[model samples]
Target: MRLETEMKMLQAKSQAGIVKEETVGNASRFIDVSAKHTKLPHFQDGKDDLDIWLTRFERFAESNSWSRDKWSSSLCALLTGRALGCFWRLSSEQAQDYDKVKLALMNRYDLTEDGYRRMFRS
Candidate 1:
């Protein structure tokens, strides 16, 4: 009976993890879809354009007095797909910046100047 209880507990934990992962995945997809529809100045590549978009977003967020959490979440939603594909192509420092931004968003309203490094990392 104890073994069975432990197995059930493990299964519950696994299911909970899967649900969290799905939530994150859905959020990532939302980001991708939003990015696809956003209009921007013409650029050579989508990945390059993503940088410009992020800069514009930061400026807008600042001007509007957006909270750090809002800015981070919005940026993550915008860059999620592009980040996955282009991050590896970026420099080591650039990748670190991306990770920082992502972590900040995950942590909520706690981003810093370092998080903005992603804007120039490309």
Candidate 2:
């Protein structure tokens, strides 16, 4: 009777282990729908975080086979704060234009003077 109970307990533990292994991969998988919207690094204006955001965005674009224009617009979805409002005001027609969106973002979020200095020195 003891050996039978121990065998049943081992079987239950093995089943639980299999379940955990299967769930680990599903939990970690990320779907990049226009940069995964939620995962885009917040680009607060004048912060030293655009480089980080750009690298992540680039990876997202490549993984999802998105064009620069698509990236340009989806980027608007990731905006927060005053920046989010700025993108919202864009006319649907204007929003369809990638250059306009990109230019607007660059104008608002251009790096600080220190960033330029660092660029020139390197």
Candidate 3:
């Protein structure tokens, strides 16, 4: 009965996405029992529209129940070319902020309100 109780507790922890810490001798390691990692869409400069891509990314993140605070790092994984360059140019602190990163990308890609108006006029 005691072993069954422990197994039930372990199962509950797994479902809650808890990290298990195991220590052997003097060493300790963390085991991730979280859900499977979800892959975000990759952004390709010139090929993908920044505005549309960002919208899609947000939707995908929401659908996958990704933590809002982790979106910056998660989005960073799929950036490439000029988009990736813009991320790299940000200060370490700014890079960690999704809003700042999005702002920088929008500015770099000329997606501001005036820029959109100019595009529409052209």
Candidate 4:
């Protein structure tokens, strides 16, 4: 299977909520295997850590034409509120904190600072 397809499948499994032990085991296996092969530096360098993932995601948003306010809000709602924080590894509190930080960064930079944008861009 393609890497993107594999990643999507794993992400879906992770979002499906905790099930039987066997199911959890399978999801864990998929994540472990994917992490081992992914080319993303954050994943390869043992920095696929939650914070790093958030940083990378923010950077991706900044590079686009979308306004920082919209991007940050949407990301906080999508990633932290629904996907990663809700379905993946981070706890609710952690997710909330991440959203706060992302929003703060957006506000601080007025959405124009190259350094701020670069921090999360890629």
Candidate that scores best on lDDT: 3
- Model 3 reaches what TM-score against the true structure? 0.72
- Looking at model 2, the pairs that clash are none
Q: In model 1, which regions exceed 4 Å deviation?
A: 1-48, 84-99, 102-122
Q: Whole-model lDDT for model 1 versus the true structure?
A: 0.46
TM-score of each: 0.31, 0.46, 0.72, 0.27
**What residue runs in model 3 are displaced by over 4 Å at the alpha carbon?**
1-38
Who is ahead in TM-score, 1 or 3? Answer: 3
| Steric clash pairs (candidate 3) | none
Clashing pairs in 4: 59-120, 59-121
Q: What are the lDDT figures for the candidates, one per model?
A: 0.46, 0.61, 0.86, 0.46
What lDDT tens digits, residue by residue, belong to model 4 across residues 11-52? 776555322123564454433332333232322222234445
lDDT of 3 by residue, 22-97 (tens): 6799975556645445555689887999999999999988876668889999889989999999999999999999
Each model's backbone clash number: 0, 0, 0, 2
lDDT of 1 at 25: 44
* RMSD (Å) of each candidate, 1 decimal: 13.8, 12.4, 8.5, 14.4
Clashing residue pairs in candidate 1 (N, C-alpha, C atoms within 3 angstroms) = none
List the lowest-lDDT window of 10 residues for candidate 1. 28-37
Tens digit per residue, CA lDDT, model 1, 1-122: 99789656655654543211224644521122223344433223334544445567767666654565544445544454435444334555544454455443323322346645664575
